[model samples]
Target chain A: MTVTLASLSQQTGLAVLDHLERSASIPVVHGLQAQGDLIVIPLPVIASSVKVWPDSHWKDVPGEGVELLRGAAGGNPHTLVADPGTCRWTTHVLDSDQLAIGVFETSAVAYLLHPEHGATGCPPGTYVIRRQREHEGQRARLVAD
Target chain B: MRREAAEIREEWLGRALSTLPADRPAAEAAISGLYHLIGLAPPRFHWVSSPVTALTTVPPGIRTRPSETADRVSAWPLPSQFSSLMRQLCLALDAQVRWGHQSMDRLIRQKVRSPLALSTEGSLRMPLLAAHDSRHRFQSTWYDTQCVSWIAHYDALRRAAGVLFTPEQNRQLDLWAAVARSGGWWWPREGACVISERPVTMRTEVCGDDGEVRLHSADSPAVRYADGWDVHAWHGTRVPSWVITDPSVQRIGREANVEVRRCAIEHIGWASYIDQAGLRLVASAPDPGNPGSELRLYDMRRETRVLLAVNGSVERDGQRRRYGLTVPGFLDDPIAAAGWTYGLSAEQYSLLLRRT
Candidate 1:
């Protein structure tokens, strides 16, 4: 079945901009993709710098969705959604940059949705979700686009 | 319970940031009751338009000793007694919070109390503290004692969570709540009590999960008092009026406080700041993992560089936004500088990935 933004939003009970093309099917990218301030990276690609704990407690992604992160000023949450049991998520991970928000492993395609960013599909795989950051002066600050 | 606590928290925050004319009689009565609780008669009341005026002017008929001067604002014994009285009241109310409601109390503390405290710090207390004779030199217990957060905490405990308070505790709580709901800051002396009126106008932006707010206005003073005292802020950071009304590259360069400097630069827009400040170009590279986005690095100042990157996503108007991040000057590669922001090496960040 083809998955458009409207279908994705309807399935997850999330809202997207009316201006965004809602009828076109969203692409399920097999490679790394960034959605606003969140980046999805194949775990092995950054295996040297990031690691998932061997005993990490993982939870199934619900039909409604799992909120990965919210913008610092409160609006616009980055929600990860997938068919129930298709994706599992865990926040237990180590990153040298301290930017990793969590790790997700999927048996089938999963999607990351944001009100402003629309949605992007992640093909079945294990990936590390990292937040984007910027240095203000000497200190690094997370980007909440 | 958490939801109701949030409602009560917002209600108190509204009172804390109130701009209405102070309820003179209500404030006087509550303060007089507080004075009586300490076994003393209410002192003569004098009202000022702002905390600055309250601190600077001598209330009529009062001569301050060296120790009782506004400079020693936190050292006043009257405030200390009131602080003790509030603590005692909290202990009494806390005891009434049964074991079942103890967990609810803790939840309210986090959801209601803590966020309100932060909002008060940002919107009200900080301004009051800024009005102190010596900035950053005095303890803030007296100010904290007057803050409505803790008062609202117990109020929420009773009204929202259904926790009970003794009649006496309720009476005492009513007095404190009335004071909070009625006026602004206060300074008590043996024979005279000075209080401040609320600001004539104020502006703020909600900046937290629990509806917490901070002083913010792009064009004028975020907070303004009837007596002409006012404060400007950018986002939540207290800043000079120029930073809001007339931010200049030279002024941003001269600012010593990094947060204030950052606010100025942001007010000018990062892209414009880079151009106006004449930051030197260091390097440029296509950002790895985020295709189509280019990273450009510029030499900002001593030992620090700025990385300019394009956001991966398109905006509602279909334009991509550009933002800058300061980085160590030693990194010559823009991609590496971008990677460094996430505490990763260039190679680690270059992995085939996707950015929206």
Candidate 2:
């Protein structure tokens, strides 16, 4: 399926709902996750939530949170998602070889990966799992079957 | 014949002696003429015997001392021979004068044309030249009597031959001899002898800002500083004005003061420094009372002076030179300021600053 801002925004909204259900605290939506070469979420949702969070805290959360989620996802059977103001992830596999991941702020999935298993050689790729929106909204996700 | 000549000589001598003091001027003239026959001044005589004693004794014979009894005796003959010779020559010239056949010049030339030998003891002999020039010969050579007398007195023969004492010469000789015998003579031949123990005095005067002048008597306890060198401030404070110890620095300081004063009525900065090359003296015109300070650089060996700079480059005589390595801080000490004021050696600059 084609990755799109609308799909990413839907995924981010679901990620925020999961976080709120788990903690029962409103997750402060700072900004959309920015992955390399993609605007993960549609722009309208990220812009709309930016108003609710303090500028300082909001600026720090999205960039740092995306990095944590990417780390949690690891490399196998991982699902990554972002909304306009939230990011989420889950992973279930590990190898003797470790993987390196980086998260960046963007309107897309905002994740980057290399396939050399953290060694000397690998091909690199980036993808958007969600899109930011001008208002608070759900995020989209990508799943490896 | 010989007896008759002898008798004539004796008669002449007697006449000459009678004409002496009694006709004092003529006698003096006659004595002067005799001295001319010789080539020297008349002999000064010393009396071996006191005149008073010699006159009072009234000896029957010529009162001669036995050779063995006398303490000393002159090798030359008695003064009588000199007297006899002068008298004979004078008598001859006198006759020539009476005859009026020849000029006085002719008379003297005829008498003194031959050189005479003056003998002293057995050793010294001097040749007496005739005073008269034969080329100028004239009649009645008796007019040359003056020359005859002078030569005769100076002739070595007469000096070697004791001088005859007139009573006056005898008295002077007697006094001198007594003084010499008593060992009481102390006459220096030339120059005076003085004894003094006073120390030399040097005074220094310094003008203060308050218009009061402080005078330092250098004589008391002088603060002497070496030029081109630095002494501690404590040492300098004792003196009236700072004494520059280094000759080179001292010279530059003196020149700088004079030059600065002449630049204008404004306050002028003067300074000196030394380096490998030589001394440098620099002056700048500034406000009066707040005159800019001077800087100097001196080369000790070459004794040269050059201007230097301080905080900024200083233009001296239309040229700008950088001050020494240490700047802004160097300005604090007068010596340092002086040094920095002009790019100068540390020693030279410091010395000048001390003076300020």
Which regions in candidate 2 have their CA more than 4 angstroms from the true location?
Answer: A1-145, B1-202, B209-211, B215-245, B248-272, B275-356
- Model 1 per-residue lDDT at A25: 86
Interface RMSD of each: 2.4, 40.5
lDDT by residue (tens digit), candidate 2, A84-121: 45332222212111111222233433322111111010
List the lowest-lDDT window of 10 residues for candidate 1 chain B: B129-138
What is each predicted model's overall lDDT from 0 to 1?
Answer: 0.85, 0.25
CAPRI class of candidate 2 = incorrect
Error of 1 at A92 (Å): 3.3
The TM-score obtained by model 2 is: 0.12
lDDT (tens digit, per residue) of candidate 1 on B153-265:
99999998889888989999999999999998999988789999999888988777788888889999989999899988887788878899899999888877777887888
Error of 1 at B106 (Å): 3.5
